[model samples]
Target: MAKVFIYPATSLILSDLVARFGHEPLGAALSIRERIQTPGLESPPLQITPEDPKKGLRYAAVEVPSGVRGRMAIYGPLLEQSEAAIIVTDAEMAFGCMGCARTNELILFSLRQRGIPLLELTYPKSEEEGVQFVKAIREFLAGLQEGGS
Candidate 1:
C-alpha cells in the first residue's frame, strides 16, 4: 500500500478515507499520537521535544519563524515518507486547518518538488461536489493500487 499524505494533516475525514482505500495515511493525528504516547514525554499536550526545532531545520531555514520550524519538524518527515498525496484546497477550518499559512506553503512546495503522485482537489461546496470529490479521490487511490501514475 502507498503512503499517502493528506494536506491539512489534521483532517480526520481525509485520513479515514485514505485508510479506507487501503493506503497508509500520513498526517498530524498519527504523528501527534506517536508523540503523546512516547514513553518519556514530559508534555503530552505540547507533543513536542526540545530537539524538534533542530530536526525542523532540515526543512526550513534557521531564520524562519520558530513556529514554522516546529511545525515543519512534524510534517517534514511525513512528506519524506509519502509515496502519494491528496491535497484539498479552500477547505473550512473544521475540515482541517494547519493553523500556519507559511508552513502550509512550505509543505505544498516540498510535496511538489518531490514529484510524487499528487491529486489536488477543491473543497466541496455542495452535496454534488462532495460526491464528485470523494469519487475523484477513490479513483486516484485505486490508480495507485494498480501501480499506475
Candidate 2:
C-alpha cells in the first residue's frame, strides 16, 4: 500500500485511526508538548521522505492561516508536498476558533483545485461513535483499494 496521510483534529482521533488502520501515523503529534503527552503517535518505520517530492509526502498540520503572515507560513509547504490530506474538525467546533472556518474552507478549496484527495472527518458524539467512524473510513479505503486493483 502507498503512504496515506491521515490528519485528525485531535490527537486522540488521529491515534485511534492510525492504530485501527494498522499504519503507524506520521507526525500525529506535531510538537514537543504533544509528543510528551502522546508518546504513541510517531510515524511508522515504513515512512520515507523522498527528496524528489514524488515518492514522499508529509502529514498536514492543524495550524490554520488566519491572516497574510499565517497564510504565507502554513499553506505553501503543505499544499506543495502532500499528495493527499485528511482534515478533521471537532464535531462542535471547539478550540474557540475565531477565523478558522473561513481559513479551513479556503485551504480545502486550494487542496481540491490541485487534485489532491482530501478527507474531512468530524468528531463523533462518543468514544464508541468515534470507533464506528474510523471503521467506516477503513471500509471506505478498502473499497477504494479493491476498486483500484
TM-score top scorer: 1
- The predictions' CA RMSDs to the true structure, in order, are 5.2, 8.9
Residue 82 miss distance in model 1 (angstroms): 0.3
Error of 2 at 72 (Å): 4.3
Give the per-residue lDDT digits (tens) of candidate 1, residues 18-87: 9998889898773223334444212124658768888899999999988789888888988998989999
Taking all chains together, each candidate's TM-score versus the true structure is 0.86, 0.47
What lDDT, from 0 to 1, does candidate 2 have?
0.44
- lDDT for each candidate structure: 0.83, 0.44
CA lDDT, candidate 1, residue 101: 86
lDDT of 2 by residue, 1-149 (tens): 32334443235455455446644333223321322233232222233333322321222234432242243234445555545555555644231121344544655565667665456767678889878867766764443331122
**Positional deviation of 63 in candidate 1, in angstroms?**
0.7
- CA error at residue 4 for candidate 2, angstroms: 4.6
User: Candidate 2: which stretches are off by over 4 Å?
Assistant: 1-12, 15-68, 92-99, 140-149
